[model samples]
Target: MKFSPHAWAKLIYLRDRGTTEVGGFGITDPGQPRFVKDIVLVSQSCTEITVAFDDTAVADFFDDQIDAGRHPEQFARIWIHTHPGRSAEPSGVDHETFARVFGNCDWAVMFILARNGATYAELKRTGNPHSEPLSVGIDFRDEFAGSNQAVWEGEYLRCVQAAPMPPIWDLDLLPGDEPYLSEQWPWLPI
Candidate 1:
């Protein structure tokens, strides 16, 4: 769950402005120092305790990467969201959502960001569905220069102002219309 300085900076900016955003990106490799790149940010509402992403956001992220010549399946996925005014620790719902949606990946990471910059991150391997989440530390390096700082700040503000969108999946989908557990997320086999 280690984040690049640029990613951390952008996340910190969002936290300071009281924005709740859902973020995810593809990882470059399978092990160590797990550098996440090309993070795509999704806007959220002020009242949200758990930020969620729409299918369009997920599709667009992969679409852009594919257009740039990268295969969507080539990257491991990590999903993140802000938990404002709460402990950065993952909630029960967080654990369930992470396990259910990302269960098919070889491994996946769920990160929670809080207002004070306190964070709780967990890395899970799908093999042990009920295993306790391994808490991980974030490596937020100080790499923001003046220009990039300003840009990150502006994006944060824009995030706060962005129109709120509803969650992509309806909690009460009609029985047969409901996606199977494996189908809840796109990158997995049913």
Candidate 2:
């Protein structure tokens, strides 16, 4: 697995879940090399022992991404979470979750990041239900990381000039709507 230096940085340095595990989407190439482009962090409500994703929200996000023309290979193909200790091995729950959630992918990957930045990774291709998860290599090139820094800084600058989105949920309301409920709002509610 290859990753933009920024993604690696986020995985290694940001453990927002305190002493527990934290996870996020690993957006990568849908083909060979599978270089990760970004890390979209998922919010967690856990402490120093366990963790889980908001599966519905995560799945919905993937659905939206797919609808938006991003290919399935980029659909959070890798499941990444940090371990509080030095061992990056997957626990029982990790193995179970990987099978349940990522089993349908053409190929699935897992990255278990240790607290001290050590890493362990594995990959399982679909249709090999009984096969052992195979080990994969992680490459964090310094040049790529440097490019990531530049891209991130550029994005931050762009956001400065962009308009912030309005806040509203569970309603047919949209950003430009003035007469909020005129004509029944058109779209079905989630």
Candidate 3:
């Protein structure tokens, strides 16, 4: 799939903005649904390993896009997200979320961009057990808008809340230590 220069730059900026993962929706060209012309980010809580969009924010985004006269194909089919690590491979969590959330759509794309510039994109269609892998690239031929850091930064700050995931292990405790495990996980009776 192709991204407009403007969208590509914005994605790169968003990916490098912080340590946590970030996600957004790609706005496609009306006549060319596979060509992402822009991007719109929704409010979300993000950690190093995950990004969860706010349901209300997502609904509002749909409303706003509808009000703007854009169809769902133009705004909702492409799920764009970043990987804070080097690998662009989707995790188990990503697979679960993609199937649970976007599986109902006629067609959808899950796109991941890693910090090392590695990318992974897969297109899923209803009734198809196998997904198609797509090549990602920047399309510079289009007359794209320039990046507005002020606007992008504002959107990033307003939409993304960096909620760090707690470490699974306490450095002071060994694997056999029960006390630390019990303290760390109060819900579990260790």
**RMSD after CA superposition, every candidate:** 9.4, 14.7, 7.0
Which ranges in model 1 have alpha carbons more than 4 Å from their true place?
19-22, 26-33, 43-46, 71-76, 130-190
lDDT-best of 1 and 3 = 3
Misplaced by over 4 Å in model 2 are 30-33, 130-190
Clashes of 2: 0
Angstrom error of the Cα, residue 179, model 3: value is: 30
lDDT of each: 0.54, 0.59, 0.85
Point to the candidate with the largest TM-score.
3
Pairs of colliding residues, candidate 3: none
lDDT per residue for candidate 3 within 89-139, as digits (tens), equals 776677878889899999999999989899999999999999999999999
Q: Against the hidden reference, what TM-scores do the models get?
A: 0.64, 0.65, 0.87
Task: Give candidate 3's error at residue 181 in angstroms.
Answer: 21
Cα lDDT for residue 85, model 1? 48
